[model samples]
Target: MSLNFKDGRSDLKRDSLMAEEQALPPSYSVQPPRQEAPEDLSARLARLDLRSSVKNGMNVSADQCTAHLKLLEAFNQLREDIGQIPGLFGIEDPIFENPETPDTHQHVQSPQALAKVRVAEKRWSVYVARAVARFEKWYSTCVPATMGGAPCNRLTGNQFCTVKGLDRVAYHGLPIKQLTLPDQLPPLDVLMVWHSYMLNPRCFFEDCFRYGKLDFFATALPWTAIDPYIDIVTFEFKPSVQAVENFETSTGLCWSNLNDGMEKTFSCPRCLSTISVPWTQGSLWTIANEMTPGNGFADGDFLAHCRVCDTKITHDYLRVLKFKADVQAFMSPSDTPLPGTLLNKDGQPGKLTVLGSPPESFFPNSLLNAGLSHRFLLLLDNPNVSMSDVRSIWEQGLTDKNLVHKAKGVRTRLLPKERLSIRRMMSRYWFNSSPFALDLAGAVIRQGSFVEKMHNIDWLHSPALKSTMERLVQKYQRFFTLMAENPGKVAVPTLDVDLAWHTHQLNPLEYYSYSDKMCYGKYIDHDDKIEETALSDAFTWTSKAYADKYGEPYSECTCWYCEAIRESHTSKLDRFFKPNKVQALEKLHGVEVPSDPLNSPHISAHNAVRDPESEAKQRVKAAELDKAYHKACAKAKKKGKPEPRRDDYFYYYAWGYPMYMPLYYPYGVPVVGGGGFYPADPCMVNTGAGSYGACAAGTCGGMAAAGGACGGGSGGCGGGCGGGGGCGGGGGCGGGGGGCGGGGGC
Candidate 1:
């Protein structure tokens, strides 16, 4: 039976217990493994309790299925590895259940069910750090400072590599051995960018078709497998010699020589003349380092004035111009097939298709939306580009009716919602691609920075780190639920939850499937650009809503107000604890006693044991207690008859007290100056207390249940009998009593 202490009541009943006992199985024989059962509809609906319509839009494939399974296997191995890390608390599957709640209530995940998610979140930082390092190494190795006779840098090189990797992932002409499988992933850098892009499945699908990377879109990256060979601590991995050689051959770039520097030479966007920029970390006024004005990539404000055309040139502007030309080709009506277009046997143009959907079906509508993005970028690049000019350029492109009319006639082939959704997603793709590419470049940079902060946190060594991570993961789930329930409303996450969310997104295929099911058929997008005031307001709303739903403070704080509240709650729970004589011994004995079962100020020993540092201290105290108890036991053994067996009532009444004391001693009562034992108070053996039954009127009939309540009691104290002066008597059968109001008894 599942126990829930949230409401301080048990689901147990005398009649139900008897019935269950009577219904026990006849033998201890093991049964055959059960077949996997389909998920209940009610459980799925409960998970999706969102504002929008629920739909299953996940595109599954053989590769994705294999990758998903492999990823799960890798995750299990990673979890076991993490568990073995020294100084971490051993894994204890804490049960969380409220059986009284309705079926529609969110079903709490079992520990095994939640294990993979936690592992993913735990290793999220490692993934980011490794991905960044991999990208850097590959960029330094294969891609140059310039590509395709155009100006390029790490930023541009990343974009080129992403497309190239997509090309490899989608290529069907390759031999079976050469195919990019779950085990054979693309270059780390390519995988990282591609992973983020896939977070928006709708956009990923259309973009894949746009570049003819249908295979790439269909096959999900085995994210857990990505870091299997890497060290979680250092977040490092060495590429195999064959893998390195493969990258060089595929890209036609040397892998050995490393080209280093920020200096970039590129053709000016307007002048069509070569311009060399000496990029530096400083801005205009910091010229002592020989830094050029308007050439500050590191400072995040790089722009150059073309002397020939007087056009303001930035890397963003250059990228926009290049992208415009690429998209414009889709509408050019050219006889030459585009990059992703399939060729016929005679080398003639075959129909452009993505997973069987004709590209012409939505080219006009999609391109028109792409124009919307292009216009936005053009205006953003240089305010001098008039809105009228952008509109005129866009209008001129639409003069061709062939692509538009053809798309209109293909209505039967495409659903209205599907076509509109594709167009909307393509528009979003354009919107994120320029200026910031928040979904692409921005995600990499932002998540990478956050991961650095996560690494600095001593996750493996710290005592509180495990619980801290658990809290963050819990909040992460709630944050997503909030977004799912609210739809378009803004919701801000605390830094901890943000880390968890970032890691969740890293496994794009799983995230996509999860969001599709949970968020009402809508992929909840993470908006990293909320205004300060708006973010603050959203956080407040989040905190209030979180408290209302979860019945706890949204975020923890060490501030005075929060501390005061914690203390208040702690004081109220103190009624459940037995009066600890360990505190009394601290005053009597000058030597320091270790913090443990009774000596520690916490109401429960479990709380003291939560921190590794605290638990280590508790161990020493426990050993000291053990030594003292055995010494007293040896002294008693000389008398024979085992000194009349110390009071069992002491164990019955003390809730959360350490029951496994040496020689059956209740508390860690210290030996004062190596004399007689400092006698503790008499045991209140009151019957009819809620938990396990206690002895009645000094009778020795009952025993306290391990990890169960001692229950509330009144004054029925009996004097101590032997050890010191008088040892308290054995316990009684305190049946059907008022249950422990606070902590569980010994």
Candidate 2:
């Protein structure tokens, strides 16, 4: 049952073969025959008189038959020669003439039979040895020219054989281009050759990085040959100008145009009074033109003296306030204002810009100009963070209003608390603590009071206040969850809230689906046309619906409502629900169900002269029966049993296997305490069984199968075949084999 490659028997066999060849007498010595050229052998095989020798049923020439008989004779001689060698094959047992009917044979063992078995085993060993020698010779010839005659030094992680020759080395059997080496190549040349070989046919190198073990090799051979040396050296390489330009084009934005001068509002540190400061757009220079005329300072070092209280406010404080300020009001017209604002210091309105009022009109282009797109892309690319989590942060940080407010508009009326409570209870299961806690459901319940107030209160409509509340709610939610999980050791979730805020401020649409909320249009009065052909081209290329809706050669439109509508129409649910729902309904009630279920002529003709109520009842009954039939079929398919007939429905439901809902943890915890979160049904929880006991009772079987077990568990986890206990038991939990607890045989 086991193969021992390190056994000394192979060494002994080699020694014996060498000794036998050496001891042979000069006349008895066997000489290898001269090899014939491939062409000559092919010609001889082609000339064979195969047709003449096929008189019977055998398709072979007389000469071939004669050669086969000779070969048999030689094989018998070889077996005899091997039998003469002592202890080559282990001791053999006697052979029975009738293996199937052992009782028919005599009880006495035959010495001759044992001898034959020993001879057979010896013959097998000799055959294997010869085959190995032939294969090795063929392999050496197949190796690359650079390593043809060289001894194999090592095997690479990718399984290629490596050999050194002169100053260079080659990997044999690897599907790479052969390097053209000089008679005397240096180490650097060898390195270059290897680099070229690794990169040959560009796609090869890409494939290696994407899906192969080429990343394992790092250094020059004979030094550190199992790691990626080139990658390590160039790991910190900066993007070239061309690369930057390519990135800009890909994102549909121009980096240089983001530097246009803009106005920013800053707050005084002492009195908390606000002031307007003119910034040289992307230059990082911030100074109040009226307060300190012609005095320019780095944004980081810029300080402002309060007009009333004479308090100096640093740029850092001002930056924080700036992000927290009301986006609309901060950019609104003001006396003694910044240059980028609609109104300058003299009270005259200024020119419109990308980052100005109605920022959503420019969309992705405006976002890129503000550097929000770059941040969002980076967050999206990170593996450690979840996209949903990043999206939540981005939405909160950037948006002026909550999603509900944006989607539904101003709510003039409010539902009573009692009515709202029932609706909330039906739709959402509110928890006291974080859902990530070990408990199946947390203790806290969301009263929806704050949400209701926000919905009804027209006075609480400041965009700044909404943005602030959004951030506070998110923070509070995360903090509550962390506190519940660790209690006394609560730690804030690691996140760059400020960065998320900046990203959101730049592009609110980054984290929202078009259907989720609509973007409000620009508020400014002026029309400053900035050509966005690239944006249009990108939108057209990326979205088929956009192209179709706008017509060919579509250009980016500044109409926010149109874009929002397009996005919402093409949302996830819009794309999938109609087709899937239709398919399911058709499979249940027949194809006619969709076009005209109530007034179909087919239904009317099928039940001719029947009353409308009776027909309706019959249709309902038929639908129920179809569902039951499908359910039975699906169950049979899963259990690998025969399908049940309609007549057997009662018997099947009463005595067949119990149907259980798939295990799930809505709170996100894989396991709570010592058990798993398994509800009685999909929506109802089983409060009687403890978490650990539920797992033991096989409730978390599906969870275990989905890699949700506490330890390394594979195989099925519950009642089906191959259901091994998720944590420690072997085989399936309730099956005919090595399961945790079952009535089946092992």
Candidate 3:
């Protein structure tokens, strides 16, 4: 009974099925329904009135109320000032007073004005640092004790797990009852983190709405209570007694005492039984060690053992469960009944009532933050997909087509088109690459870490703080430019640049507008969960690109000795063999290197003191040099030649010997004589490494003019100019005397 396998009837049947599939509506065009996002609360924030929220049962003190108003005033002023900086927020097109014959260089302030701004900025940074320090302490220990069972609940779950959405209810998942704001303001430090978090308005709003944090979201920071200080070194931040009490009462733990021992306990995913594991303090072991397979909160292999379920809980298993849950929530039909907790407009327990659909009534967060979730759903459609397969999809890069091909149902047809259409509709959040949990966690950790790092290095308190900030601003501008140019590529920032970036994100409303207009027609979202290898690769690329575009080293040592060594072109070992050279280096720079120079402090320590007389002399000399530079550019422009390149008309810092080091360009980097995007001209490079007062070298005109005395040319170590000079790049150009100050022995 051999049947004819090549039957015409079979071919006809297959063709009919193919034709039917083709005739069906393109699934890509039919996007899943997503509710419109709520209007921005910029107006409400600008003219913030907390009377409504304050009436919600929390007792408010008269003193506290007064304090909050004052703090709010200061915060608003700071926002206004930060907003005016053109490139600080994002790339701003040159605004022209007159459309015809506009001055391309008009956007730039004079070098003197720029210097004043930088100085003011340095002062503001001190307070910012203090606020950040407090925030870190609060965030690390703010876990509530009612999370799981008694013993397991006292400690915070894995910081990484909480961040990655594994422990969904920790930070974002507080019970509905504890959602209201306390009348007293949180300590300044806690407020700082909150302030920065809110500045990322979209992220903050979505998080609150998703987690039923309506009351918290409506509350405002008590700006009036804050004491703004200029000096970071002496400024002491004291959270109000009421504020402290409120925090302690709510969390059932001491805010000051965060030590919970070496091991943290949590509940098993499968069983309700508590599981204990070794814990490290910082989130994801980022502060202690690199994330390897068996390190802190390792997302591979066994997480713990569950005795009740007789199940070995692995990271893979937890992720799978979470992913499945997330997918189900994301695919929920619009007609599904709203949760009773969410339906209560009054936000009172046991007072739920059925109401018509409203703007705030919908809970679409899973779909709103569905990038990874949607992608995972497609993979799960394949019945044959294994745990390894899921892990591979997330860990490795796969294109859209490849992802679609892996799915095994009618959903595959709908997803590709649906995702694309949905993305277009929700253009504002198109760049969000991870779950909301991961994004929130990353932003919190990075911002807190940066502020703390800045404070520890004494950058906020340094006498050379202005100069340091000036350089940071420039570097940050370049960093943002790189991000705008290269889409979908990770770019790691230096500590200085990262500080500036964080500051910009603090004002979320303005940031959104600026980013949308300037940065690729959408907001550029920050992601902290990028693989270490990818971050390294991005950093290496960033360094090279930055150097090429800006013609300066992207990374520089802030240590005095290193700067001295690099500037002088002498090795550290030179102190032993070429003792005279080392002595000259110290004398020329006016810094005393210690006997054991193994651990060096920041260069700012040596360069903090200001010499009024020396500063005046330098300013006078700088004025003369600045004129000469402009004259060179003007002469070139009139001759119909290219305006003198910014690289030309250098402000040379020369030692008594025949050494020359170009220190600054008073005018910003303009391509033509008066065109292009010009940044604020940096102040004259202060070459003195001691007291920030001594004249380290000669000026372009003469040694005496530079406030330095000419002497027998011997061992004058070079000091690289600070403003915009190519640090540690060009070779030294020597001129006349050894330097003004007499040589001191090393």
- lDDT for each candidate structure: 0.31, 0.22, 0.31
Error of 2 at 557 (Å): 40
- Candidate 1 lDDT over 1-746, as tens digits, reads 11111221223332321121122121111222443874342232112111112112222222222222223233333323443343222212223343232221233322322332222222232233233334444434433322222222221111221232222222221112222333334454455555454432323433433333333433434433353433333333334566656766665434322222334456776668977654332222111312122233322345667678778865445444644544454435431122212211101112333433333323333434434445445554562553224434434444435433443444324342222222222222221223112224433332332232233332333333334444455455655555545432334454455545545544433444455345323333332221122222334445455544444444443222222222222222333442232232123222332212222111101100011212343465445444444544553367362322232222111111111222322121211101000010001111232221122211111111111111222101110000000001110111101121111000
What is the model-wide C-alpha lDDT for candidate 1?
A: 0.31
Tens digits of per-residue lDDT, candidate 2, 433-494, equal: 11110111110000011111122222122222323323322332222222222211101111
Cα-based lDDT at residue 535, candidate 3: 26
Off by over 4 Å in 2: 1-241, 245-324, 327-634, 637-746
RMSD of 2: 36.5
Q: What's the count of clashing pairs in each model shown?
A: 17, 18, 24
How should the candidates be ordered by TM-score, best one leading? 1, 3, 2
lDDT value, residue 669 of candidate 3: 17
- TM-score versus the correct structure, for each prediction: 0.40, 0.14, 0.37
Candidate 1 global Cα RMSD: 27.0
